[model samples]
Target: MKGITLLAVSVFSTAFLSFTPLNKKYIIIDAGHGGSDAGAVYGQFSEKDISLNIAKEIHKINKSQDKYEVILTRDADISSSLPDRTILINNLNPEMVISLHVNKSPEKETPKHGFEVFIQNSEGSKKLADKISKKFSAQTIVERNLHILRETKAPAVLVELGFINNTQDRNYMTSEKGQKEIAQKFVEIINEY
Candidate 1:
């Protein structure tokens, strides 16, 4: 009886371990700009800093989902070349890639505020871009020809969260509440996919 009970326990434990959700689905989050490349700047805010903060927030949120494994192309304030970023993504072979950035519109005085998602010039990429754009329409504008999207081996998109030159955009992006909301919304989008 004792032997049979031990065997049953072992079998149950093995099954549980095997079936546990470990978030094996890989995702690469590229934080655009770093080091000398401050990207767009508005007032006291730098586009590179905004992008990294938002990417890190997304990473933190996704860590709890147990269904996604998030990787960042540039985690710190160090610079990474465009080719290197592409190579890293190719090596990881993630299910999806999201490159975060801030937009700049010098010609437009009024706030050009909206989220923009870019994909490769292909059917698959367009479909993904459309879905993401539609979902984030209230906060985003859809775009294409982004380098990260074009170079990544996996299905990828570049998200221009908002324009740094716009006063309202700058304020919202730099705020803690706005960053959290943006990160949460992105997590929702990934979860849906």
Candidate 2:
């Protein structure tokens, strides 16, 4: 996590927005699971690592420009509980929360591999998910009561970036080209939102 810094450090208990003097438009990027919780794993790839890599790419891209003020829930490969993440995010009062994750299939023999975006019951959340999903040609805006989507107060999205169990998805998702492309799509989504 060297050279990685938070522009705005949030305080959790009181549940309020905090901003770096330089910027006011803020967003939180949550890199799914880390540490021992490998999320969806398949042979050479782990969802935690992949999510982090993509999140880092997003951070790097945002750092270079006077875009939105971005902050990641976990900057490194460290474990952070979903509840704690929810609490932190609720307190931050960001414009949105993008929780990066990888999708998996129960049966790898016939895998459904595609980018899927999940949204809570909120209309704004659904619209955001739809916009982003459409841009990536994703599966659809899935209305799911996922932990992050359900708990966070901000207009939140839980993006199943791609399926790790699928052959084609695995190759693209784990590659530098795919990660950067996806990261760029995220930036586009945020800016356009």
RMSD of each: 11.4, 4.9
The TM-score, computed over Cα atoms with residue i paired to residue i, of candidate 2 is: 0.88
The segments of candidate 2 whose C-alpha lies over 4 angstroms from its true place after superposition are: 1-19
Judged by lDDT, which candidate is best?
2
C-alpha RMSD of candidate 1: 11.4
Q: Candidate 1: which pairs clash?
A: 115-139, 115-140, 115-141
Candidate 1 CA-lDDT value = 0.79
Q: After superposition, how far is residue 137 of candidate 2 from its true place, in Å?
A: 0.7
Assess each prediction's global lDDT (C-alpha) against the native.
0.79, 0.84
Best by TM-score: 2
Q: 91-121 in candidate 2: lDDT tens per residue?
A: 6678899999998998847999899888999
Error of 1 at 142 (Å): 5.5
What TM-score, computed on C-alpha atoms, does each candidate reach?
0.82, 0.88
Q: Write the per-residue lDDT of candidate 1 for residues 88-131, one digit (tens) a residue.
A: 67755677888898999876658677777776766656666776
Q: Model 1 TM-score?
A: 0.82
